[model samples]
Target: MAKETYQSLQAQIRKLQEKAETVRLKQRQPIVASILRSMQEYSITLDELKAAQAKGVSGRKRSVGTAKPAAKAPARQVAPKYRHPETGETWTGRGKPPRWLVAAEGAGATRDQFLIAQ
Candidate 1:
Protein backbone atom coordinates (compact mmCIF):
# COMPACT_ATOMS: atom_id res chain seq x y z
CA MET A 1 0.00 0.00 0.00
CA ALA A 2 2.76 2.48 0.94
CA LYS A 3 4.59 1.69 -2.30
CA GLU A 4 1.46 2.35 -4.31
CA THR A 5 0.90 5.68 -2.56
CA TYR A 6 4.50 6.70 -3.20
CA GLN A 7 4.18 5.89 -6.90
CA SER A 8 0.92 7.84 -7.17
CA LEU A 9 2.47 10.84 -5.45
CA GLN A 10 5.41 10.76 -7.85
CA ALA A 11 3.08 10.68 -10.83
CA GLN A 12 1.13 13.65 -9.50
CA ILE A 13 4.37 15.58 -8.94
CA ARG A 14 5.44 14.88 -12.53
CA LYS A 15 2.10 16.13 -13.88
CA LEU A 16 2.34 19.27 -11.75
CA GLN A 17 5.84 19.95 -13.03
CA GLU A 18 4.64 19.66 -16.60
CA LYS A 19 1.73 22.02 -15.94
CA ALA A 20 4.09 24.56 -14.35
CA GLU A 21 6.44 24.37 -17.29
CA THR A 22 3.59 24.94 -19.73
CA VAL A 23 2.36 27.96 -17.78
CA ARG A 24 5.85 29.43 -17.69
CA LEU A 25 6.22 28.98 -21.40
CA LYS A 26 2.90 30.64 -22.07
CA GLN A 27 3.93 33.63 -19.92
CA ARG A 28 7.27 33.99 -21.72
CA GLN A 29 5.87 33.81 -25.28
CA PRO A 30 4.70 37.44 -25.41
CA ILE A 31 8.04 38.73 -24.07
CA VAL A 32 9.93 36.70 -26.68
CA ALA A 33 7.69 37.92 -29.50
CA SER A 34 8.07 41.55 -28.40
CA ILE A 35 11.88 41.17 -28.27
CA LEU A 36 11.92 39.82 -31.84
CA ARG A 37 9.77 42.72 -33.06
CA SER A 38 12.02 45.26 -31.35
CA MET A 39 15.09 43.67 -32.92
CA GLN A 40 13.57 43.93 -36.41
CA GLU A 41 12.74 47.62 -35.84
CA TYR A 42 16.29 48.31 -34.65
CA SER A 43 17.75 46.63 -37.75
CA ILE A 44 15.53 48.71 -40.02
CA THR A 45 16.61 51.90 -38.29
CA LEU A 46 20.27 50.91 -38.58
CA ASP A 47 19.87 50.26 -42.32
CA GLU A 48 18.25 53.68 -42.78
CA LEU A 49 21.12 55.36 -40.90
CA LYS A 50 23.66 53.64 -43.13
CA ALA A 51 21.81 54.74 -46.25
CA ALA A 52 21.69 58.35 -45.01
CA GLN A 53 25.44 58.27 -44.28
CA ALA A 54 26.15 56.98 -47.78
CA LYS A 55 24.04 59.74 -49.31
CA GLY A 56 25.91 62.33 -47.25
CA VAL A 57 29.32 61.04 -48.43
CA SER A 58 28.25 61.31 -52.06
CA GLY A 59 27.95 65.04 -52.70
CA ARG A 60 24.65 66.24 -54.12
CA LYS A 61 24.79 66.08 -57.92
CA ARG A 62 21.72 66.44 -60.13
CA SER A 63 21.64 63.64 -62.69
CA VAL A 64 19.61 65.82 -65.04
CA GLY A 65 20.55 69.18 -66.67
CA THR A 66 22.71 71.83 -65.00
CA ALA A 67 19.77 74.18 -64.41
CA LYS A 68 18.58 73.45 -60.88
CA PRO A 69 14.81 73.29 -60.76
CA ALA A 70 13.18 76.18 -58.89
CA ALA A 71 12.14 75.38 -55.31
CA LYS A 72 8.38 74.72 -54.97
CA ALA A 73 6.46 77.12 -52.79
CA PRO A 74 4.28 75.71 -50.01
CA ALA A 75 0.83 74.55 -51.06
CA ARG A 76 -1.79 77.28 -50.64
CA GLN A 77 -4.09 76.92 -47.61
CA VAL A 78 -7.19 77.38 -49.75
CA ALA A 79 -8.10 74.71 -52.26
CA PRO A 80 -7.25 75.56 -55.86
CA LYS A 81 -8.61 74.27 -59.16
CA TYR A 82 -6.48 72.15 -61.49
CA ARG A 83 -7.04 71.51 -65.19
CA HIS A 84 -5.29 69.22 -67.64
CA PRO A 85 -4.88 71.21 -70.85
CA GLU A 86 -4.47 68.10 -72.98
CA THR A 87 -7.44 66.20 -71.56
CA GLY A 88 -9.51 69.24 -70.59
CA GLU A 89 -10.26 67.35 -67.32
CA THR A 90 -10.78 69.59 -64.28
CA TRP A 91 -10.42 68.75 -60.58
CA THR A 92 -10.79 70.87 -57.45
CA GLY A 93 -7.55 70.99 -55.42
CA ARG A 94 -9.26 70.17 -52.09
CA GLY A 95 -6.33 68.09 -50.83
CA LYS A 96 -2.72 67.32 -51.69
CA PRO A 97 -2.06 66.20 -55.25
CA PRO A 98 -1.30 62.54 -55.91
CA ARG A 99 2.12 61.13 -56.91
CA TRP A 100 1.10 61.31 -60.58
CA LEU A 101 0.77 65.11 -60.33
CA VAL A 102 4.23 65.50 -58.82
CA ALA A 103 5.69 63.23 -61.50
CA ALA A 104 3.92 65.24 -64.20
CA GLU A 105 5.23 68.49 -62.71
CA GLY A 106 8.76 67.03 -62.65
CA ALA A 107 8.30 66.15 -66.34
CA GLY A 108 7.96 69.91 -67.20
CA ALA A 109 4.24 70.61 -66.82
CA THR A 110 3.74 74.05 -65.23
CA ARG A 111 1.91 72.89 -62.08
CA ASP A 112 1.26 76.35 -60.72
CA GLN A 113 -0.18 77.38 -64.06
CA PHE A 114 -2.71 74.58 -63.72
CA LEU A 115 -3.71 75.67 -60.21
CA ILE A 116 -7.31 76.90 -60.17
CA ALA A 117 -7.91 80.32 -58.57
CA GLN A 118 -9.56 80.28 -55.15
Candidate 2:
Protein backbone atom coordinates (compact mmCIF):
# COMPACT_ATOMS: atom_id res chain seq x y z
CA MET A 1 0.00 0.00 0.00
CA ALA A 2 3.06 2.27 0.49
CA LYS A 3 4.11 4.64 -2.36
CA GLU A 4 7.13 3.48 -4.40
CA THR A 5 10.32 5.63 -4.34
CA TYR A 6 11.76 7.06 -7.63
CA GLN A 7 14.60 4.48 -7.54
CA SER A 8 12.10 1.63 -6.99
CA LEU A 9 9.98 2.88 -9.93
CA GLN A 10 13.08 3.00 -12.17
CA ALA A 11 14.09 -0.53 -11.16
CA GLN A 12 10.56 -1.73 -11.90
CA ILE A 13 10.68 -0.09 -15.34
CA ARG A 14 14.01 -1.79 -16.15
CA LYS A 15 12.66 -5.15 -15.03
CA LEU A 16 9.50 -4.65 -17.10
CA GLN A 17 11.54 -3.67 -20.16
CA GLU A 18 13.63 -6.84 -19.89
CA LYS A 19 10.50 -8.93 -19.47
CA ALA A 20 8.89 -7.20 -22.48
CA GLU A 21 11.95 -7.91 -24.64
CA THR A 22 11.93 -11.58 -23.65
CA VAL A 23 8.24 -11.85 -24.39
CA ARG A 24 8.67 -10.08 -27.72
CA LEU A 25 11.46 -12.44 -28.78
CA LYS A 26 9.50 -15.46 -27.65
CA GLN A 27 6.45 -14.29 -29.60
CA ARG A 28 8.49 -13.48 -32.74
CA GLN A 29 10.39 -16.78 -32.79
CA PRO A 30 7.37 -18.78 -34.03
CA ILE A 31 6.44 -16.14 -36.64
CA VAL A 32 10.01 -15.94 -37.94
CA ALA A 33 10.24 -19.76 -38.12
CA SER A 34 6.93 -19.92 -39.99
CA ILE A 35 8.13 -17.24 -42.45
CA LEU A 36 11.34 -19.18 -43.05
CA ARG A 37 9.34 -22.35 -43.58
CA SER A 38 7.07 -20.61 -46.08
CA MET A 39 10.05 -19.11 -47.90
CA GLN A 40 11.72 -22.51 -48.19
CA GLU A 41 8.48 -24.17 -49.31
CA TYR A 42 7.99 -21.47 -51.99
CA SER A 43 11.71 -21.27 -52.90
CA ILE A 44 11.74 -17.52 -52.21
CA THR A 45 15.11 -15.76 -52.48
CA LEU A 46 16.43 -12.73 -50.63
CA ASP A 47 16.63 -10.82 -53.91
CA GLU A 48 12.92 -11.43 -54.52
CA LEU A 49 12.19 -10.23 -50.99
CA LYS A 50 14.22 -7.07 -51.64
CA ALA A 51 12.41 -6.50 -54.94
CA ALA A 52 9.07 -6.82 -53.24
CA GLN A 53 10.19 -4.35 -50.58
CA ALA A 54 11.37 -1.92 -53.25
CA LYS A 55 7.96 -2.15 -54.91
CA GLY A 56 6.28 -1.34 -51.55
CA VAL A 57 4.25 -4.54 -51.82
CA SER A 58 3.78 -4.81 -48.05
CA GLY A 59 5.13 -3.70 -44.63
CA ARG A 60 8.36 -1.73 -44.03
CA LYS A 61 11.52 -2.88 -45.85
CA ARG A 62 14.24 -4.72 -43.99
CA SER A 63 17.88 -5.44 -44.86
CA VAL A 64 19.76 -8.34 -43.33
CA GLY A 65 23.58 -8.47 -42.88
CA THR A 66 25.34 -7.79 -46.24
CA ALA A 67 22.18 -6.16 -47.65
CA LYS A 68 21.95 -3.62 -44.83
CA PRO A 69 22.66 0.09 -45.40
CA ALA A 70 26.29 0.59 -46.43
CA ALA A 71 28.62 2.48 -44.15
CA LYS A 72 29.80 5.71 -45.78
CA ALA A 73 33.42 5.93 -46.98
CA PRO A 74 35.76 7.99 -44.82
CA ALA A 75 36.51 11.55 -45.99
CA ARG A 76 40.01 12.12 -47.38
CA GLN A 77 42.25 14.57 -45.52
CA VAL A 78 42.88 17.82 -47.44
CA ALA A 79 46.47 19.01 -47.77
CA PRO A 80 47.32 22.48 -46.50
CA LYS A 81 47.50 25.01 -49.36
CA TYR A 82 49.10 27.87 -47.46
CA ARG A 83 51.60 28.19 -44.58
CA HIS A 84 52.91 31.16 -42.60
CA PRO A 85 56.60 31.76 -43.33
CA GLU A 86 57.45 32.97 -39.81
CA THR A 87 54.96 31.19 -37.46
CA GLY A 88 54.56 28.10 -39.71
CA GLU A 89 50.73 28.09 -39.33
CA THR A 90 48.91 26.06 -42.01
CA TRP A 91 45.49 26.31 -43.77
CA THR A 92 43.74 23.81 -46.07
CA GLY A 93 42.16 26.62 -48.18
CA ARG A 94 38.75 25.84 -46.59
CA GLY A 95 36.42 28.27 -44.78
CA LYS A 96 37.62 31.62 -43.35
CA PRO A 97 41.30 32.56 -43.24
CA PRO A 98 43.02 32.44 -39.84
CA ARG A 99 43.74 35.67 -37.90
CA TRP A 100 47.47 35.53 -38.74
CA LEU A 101 46.75 35.07 -42.49
CA VAL A 102 44.13 37.89 -42.40
CA ALA A 103 46.57 40.15 -40.52
CA ALA A 104 49.34 39.35 -43.01
CA GLU A 105 47.06 40.11 -45.98
CA GLY A 106 46.09 43.39 -44.28
CA ALA A 107 49.80 44.19 -43.91
CA GLY A 108 50.19 44.15 -47.76
CA ALA A 109 51.28 40.46 -48.01
CA THR A 110 49.68 38.61 -50.96
CA ARG A 111 48.16 35.08 -50.82
CA ASP A 112 50.58 34.00 -53.60
CA GLN A 113 53.51 34.66 -51.21
CA PHE A 114 52.02 32.22 -48.63
CA LEU A 115 51.32 29.34 -51.08
CA ILE A 116 53.04 26.10 -49.99
CA ALA A 117 55.37 24.79 -52.72
CA GLN A 118 54.44 21.43 -54.26
Candidate 3:
Protein backbone atom coordinates (compact mmCIF):
# COMPACT_ATOMS: atom_id res chain seq x y z
CA MET A 1 0.00 0.00 0.00
CA ALA A 2 1.22 3.49 -0.87
CA LYS A 3 2.04 5.93 2.00
CA GLU A 4 -0.57 8.61 2.71
CA THR A 5 0.09 12.04 1.15
CA TYR A 6 0.08 15.21 3.33
CA GLN A 7 -3.20 16.40 1.75
CA SER A 8 -4.80 12.96 2.23
CA LEU A 9 -3.83 12.90 5.96
CA GLN A 10 -5.27 16.41 6.38
CA ALA A 11 -8.53 15.31 4.70
CA GLN A 12 -8.74 12.31 7.02
CA ILE A 13 -8.20 14.57 10.05
CA ARG A 14 -10.96 16.93 8.88
CA LYS A 15 -13.38 14.03 8.35
CA LEU A 16 -12.56 12.67 11.83
CA GLN A 17 -13.13 16.08 13.43
CA GLU A 18 -16.52 16.41 11.74
CA LYS A 19 -17.51 12.90 12.81
CA ALA A 20 -16.43 13.63 16.40
CA GLU A 21 -18.48 16.84 16.45
CA THR A 22 -21.56 15.01 15.14
CA VAL A 23 -21.21 12.39 17.91
CA ARG A 24 -20.70 15.10 20.52
CA LEU A 25 -23.81 17.02 19.48
CA LYS A 26 -25.90 13.84 19.48
CA GLN A 27 -24.74 13.06 23.01
CA ARG A 28 -25.19 16.61 24.29
CA GLN A 29 -28.65 17.39 22.85
CA PRO A 30 -30.58 15.48 25.52
CA ILE A 31 -28.35 16.82 28.29
CA VAL A 32 -28.84 20.41 27.08
CA ALA A 33 -32.62 20.00 26.83
CA SER A 34 -32.77 18.53 30.33
CA ILE A 35 -30.73 21.40 31.74
CA LEU A 36 -32.91 24.01 30.01
CA ARG A 37 -36.09 22.35 31.29
CA SER A 38 -34.74 22.24 34.84
CA MET A 39 -33.63 25.88 34.66
CA GLN A 40 -37.04 27.02 33.41
CA GLU A 41 -38.87 24.89 35.97
CA TYR A 42 -36.79 26.39 38.79
CA SER A 43 -36.88 29.96 37.37
CA ILE A 44 -33.11 29.94 37.84
CA THR A 45 -31.41 33.24 37.11
CA LEU A 46 -27.93 33.56 35.61
CA ASP A 47 -26.69 35.04 38.87
CA GLU A 48 -27.88 31.93 40.72
CA LEU A 49 -26.16 29.72 38.15
CA LYS A 50 -22.90 31.59 38.59
CA ALA A 51 -23.25 31.46 42.37
CA ALA A 52 -23.77 27.71 42.25
CA GLN A 53 -20.72 27.30 39.98
CA ALA A 54 -18.61 29.40 42.33
CA LYS A 55 -19.82 27.41 45.31
CA GLY A 56 -18.88 24.19 43.57
CA VAL A 57 -15.38 25.45 42.76
CA SER A 58 -14.66 26.85 46.24
CA GLY A 59 -16.00 23.77 47.99
CA ARG A 60 -13.41 21.53 46.34
CA LYS A 61 -10.33 20.92 48.52
CA ARG A 62 -7.08 22.16 47.01
CA SER A 63 -4.29 19.66 46.42
CA VAL A 64 -1.15 19.78 48.60
CA GLY A 65 1.57 22.21 47.36
CA THR A 66 -0.79 23.72 44.74
CA ALA A 67 -0.68 27.54 44.39
CA LYS A 68 -3.51 28.51 42.08
CA PRO A 69 -4.96 32.00 42.42
CA ALA A 70 -8.44 32.54 43.86
CA ALA A 71 -11.32 33.00 41.41
CA LYS A 72 -12.57 36.53 40.79
CA ALA A 73 -15.95 37.62 42.21
CA PRO A 74 -18.99 37.49 39.96
CA ALA A 75 -19.93 40.77 38.29
CA ARG A 76 -22.87 42.80 39.57
CA GLN A 77 -25.83 43.22 37.25
CA VAL A 78 -26.70 46.76 36.17
CA ALA A 79 -30.27 48.09 36.13
CA PRO A 80 -31.82 48.99 32.80
CA LYS A 81 -31.40 52.59 31.73
CA TYR A 82 -33.76 52.70 28.75
CA ARG A 83 -37.23 51.38 27.93
CA HIS A 84 -39.43 51.31 24.84
CA PRO A 85 -42.72 53.06 25.48
CA GLU A 86 -44.80 50.70 23.37
CA THR A 87 -43.05 47.36 23.90
CA GLY A 88 -41.75 48.02 27.43
CA GLU A 89 -38.43 46.55 26.36
CA THR A 90 -35.42 47.74 28.37
CA TRP A 91 -31.67 48.06 27.94
CA THR A 92 -28.87 48.71 30.41
CA GLY A 93 -27.19 51.27 28.08
CA ARG A 94 -24.08 49.04 28.00
CA GLY A 95 -22.61 47.35 24.91
CA LYS A 96 -23.94 47.79 21.36
CA PRO A 97 -27.41 49.29 21.23
CA PRO A 98 -30.26 46.82 20.62
CA ARG A 99 -31.84 46.50 17.16
CA TRP A 100 -35.10 48.22 18.18
CA LEU A 101 -33.19 51.25 19.46
CA VAL A 102 -31.06 51.44 16.31
CA ALA A 103 -34.07 51.16 14.00
CA ALA A 104 -35.95 53.79 15.98
CA GLU A 105 -32.95 56.10 15.69
CA GLY A 106 -32.99 55.59 11.92
CA ALA A 107 -36.68 56.53 11.96
CA GLY A 108 -35.75 59.92 13.54
CA ALA A 109 -36.22 59.02 17.22
CA THR A 110 -33.51 60.21 19.59
CA ARG A 111 -31.88 57.77 22.06
CA ASP A 112 -32.82 60.05 24.96
CA GLN A 113 -36.49 59.48 24.16
CA PHE A 114 -36.13 55.92 25.43
CA LEU A 115 -34.28 56.83 28.62
CA ILE A 116 -36.03 55.42 31.68
CA ALA A 117 -37.16 58.02 34.21
CA GLN A 118 -35.00 57.92 37.33
Candidate 4:
Protein backbone atom coordinates (compact mmCIF):
# COMPACT_ATOMS: atom_id res chain seq x y z
CA MET A 1 0.00 0.00 0.00
CA ALA A 2 2.25 2.82 -1.22
CA LYS A 3 0.95 6.36 -1.55
CA GLU A 4 1.49 7.95 -5.02
CA THR A 5 3.50 11.19 -4.96
CA TYR A 6 2.75 14.05 -7.40
CA GLN A 7 5.99 13.45 -9.30
CA SER A 8 5.28 9.69 -9.57
CA LEU A 9 1.72 10.37 -10.79
CA GLN A 10 3.01 12.90 -13.33
CA ALA A 11 5.58 10.47 -14.64
CA GLN A 12 2.96 7.74 -14.93
CA ILE A 13 0.65 10.11 -16.79
CA ARG A 14 3.41 11.04 -19.25
CA LYS A 15 4.25 7.39 -19.80
CA LEU A 16 0.59 6.53 -20.41
CA GLN A 17 0.22 9.45 -22.83
CA GLU A 18 3.25 8.35 -24.83
CA LYS A 19 1.98 4.77 -24.90
CA ALA A 20 -1.46 5.96 -26.04
CA GLU A 21 0.09 8.04 -28.82
CA THR A 22 2.22 5.10 -29.93
CA VAL A 23 -0.87 2.88 -30.01
CA ARG A 24 -2.75 5.52 -31.98
CA LEU A 25 0.00 5.76 -34.56
CA LYS A 26 0.14 2.00 -34.85
CA GLN A 27 -3.62 1.89 -35.42
CA ARG A 28 -3.36 4.63 -38.03
CA GLN A 29 -0.50 2.99 -39.95
CA PRO A 30 -2.68 0.45 -41.78
CA ILE A 31 -5.18 3.14 -42.81
CA VAL A 32 -2.39 5.36 -44.06
CA ALA A 33 -0.82 2.53 -46.01
CA SER A 34 -4.19 1.61 -47.54
CA ILE A 35 -4.75 5.23 -48.59
CA LEU A 36 -1.33 5.33 -50.20
CA ARG A 37 -1.94 2.04 -51.99
CA SER A 38 -5.34 3.23 -53.22
CA MET A 39 -3.86 6.45 -54.52
CA GLN A 40 -1.24 4.55 -56.42
CA GLU A 41 -3.63 1.87 -57.74
CA TYR A 42 -6.29 4.36 -58.87
CA SER A 43 -3.82 6.93 -60.13
CA ILE A 44 -5.41 9.46 -57.78
CA THR A 45 -3.47 12.27 -56.13
CA LEU A 46 -3.81 13.54 -52.54
CA ASP A 47 -4.42 17.08 -53.77
CA GLU A 48 -7.35 15.87 -55.88
CA LEU A 49 -8.92 14.12 -52.90
CA LYS A 50 -8.45 17.21 -50.75
CA ALA A 51 -10.06 19.42 -53.38
CA ALA A 52 -13.03 17.06 -53.70
CA GLN A 53 -13.45 16.94 -49.92
CA ALA A 54 -13.38 20.73 -49.65
CA LYS A 55 -15.88 21.13 -52.49
CA GLY A 56 -18.27 18.58 -50.98
CA VAL A 57 -18.11 20.12 -47.51
CA SER A 58 -18.61 23.78 -48.58
CA GLY A 59 -21.09 23.04 -51.41
CA ARG A 60 -19.11 25.35 -53.66
CA LYS A 61 -18.05 24.69 -57.25
CA ARG A 62 -14.29 25.06 -57.13
CA SER A 63 -12.83 25.11 -60.62
CA VAL A 64 -9.09 25.57 -60.26
CA GLY A 65 -7.95 22.58 -58.20
CA THR A 66 -10.70 19.97 -58.36
CA ALA A 67 -11.02 16.95 -60.62
CA LYS A 68 -14.26 15.97 -62.41
CA PRO A 69 -17.30 15.87 -60.15
CA ALA A 70 -18.50 12.52 -58.92
CA ALA A 71 -21.81 11.06 -60.11
CA LYS A 72 -23.59 12.31 -57.00
CA ALA A 73 -23.84 15.80 -55.53
CA PRO A 74 -23.43 16.64 -51.87
CA ALA A 75 -25.98 14.99 -49.56
CA ARG A 76 -28.06 18.14 -49.23
CA GLN A 77 -27.82 21.84 -48.59
CA VAL A 78 -28.47 23.00 -45.05
CA ALA A 79 -30.68 26.07 -44.60
CA PRO A 80 -29.80 28.57 -41.93
CA LYS A 81 -31.62 27.87 -38.69
CA TYR A 82 -30.75 31.01 -36.78
CA ARG A 83 -30.72 34.73 -37.43
CA HIS A 84 -29.59 37.77 -35.50
CA PRO A 85 -32.47 40.18 -34.83
CA GLU A 86 -30.85 43.59 -35.07
CA THR A 87 -28.11 42.85 -37.62
CA GLY A 88 -30.15 40.31 -39.64
CA GLU A 89 -27.18 37.95 -39.65
CA THR A 90 -27.83 34.26 -40.26
CA TRP A 91 -26.28 30.97 -39.12
CA THR A 92 -26.93 27.34 -39.89
CA GLY A 93 -26.25 26.38 -36.25
CA ARG A 94 -23.93 23.67 -37.53
CA GLY A 95 -20.32 24.21 -36.53
CA LYS A 96 -19.36 27.49 -34.82
CA PRO A 97 -21.09 30.79 -34.28
CA PRO A 98 -20.45 33.62 -36.69
CA ARG A 99 -18.71 36.76 -35.39
CA TRP A 100 -21.96 38.75 -35.25
CA LEU A 101 -23.58 36.04 -33.15
CA VAL A 102 -20.57 35.92 -30.83
CA ALA A 103 -20.72 39.71 -30.48
CA ALA A 104 -24.43 39.53 -29.74
CA GLU A 105 -23.79 36.92 -27.08
CA GLY A 106 -21.07 39.14 -25.64
CA ALA A 107 -23.66 41.92 -25.53
CA GLY A 108 -25.77 39.66 -23.24
CA ALA A 109 -28.18 38.20 -25.76
CA THR A 110 -28.91 34.46 -25.42
CA ARG A 111 -28.49 32.08 -28.39
CA ASP A 112 -32.26 31.51 -28.57
CA GLN A 113 -32.66 35.22 -29.20
CA PHE A 114 -31.19 34.63 -32.65
CA LEU A 115 -33.48 31.79 -33.72
CA ILE A 116 -34.80 32.19 -37.24
CA ALA A 117 -38.56 32.42 -37.15
CA GLN A 118 -40.03 29.33 -38.77
Q: How does each model score on lDDT?
A: 0.73, 0.92, 0.91, 0.87
Candidate 3: residue 92 lDDT (0-100): 99
lDDT of 4 by residue, 70-100 (tens): 7876678789999877767788999988999
List the candidate 2 regions with Cα displacement exceeding 4 Å: 59-118
Best prediction by lDDT:
2
Q: Write the per-residue lDDT of candidate 2 for residues 1-118, one digit (tens) a residue.
A: 9999999999999999999999999999999999899999999988998889889786765667668666799998999999999989999999999999999999999999999999
lDDT of 2 at 104: 90
Error in Å for residue 100 of model 1:
74
Candidate 3 vs. truth: CA RMSD? 21.2
Per-model TM-score on C-alpha atoms: 0.33, 0.48, 0.44, 0.44
- Record all residue pairs in model 3 with backbone atoms less than 3 Å apart, i.e. clashing: none
Query: Any residue pairs clashing in model 2, and if so which?
Result: none
Model 3: lDDT of residue 23 = 100
Candidate 3 Cα deviation (angstroms), residue 51? 36
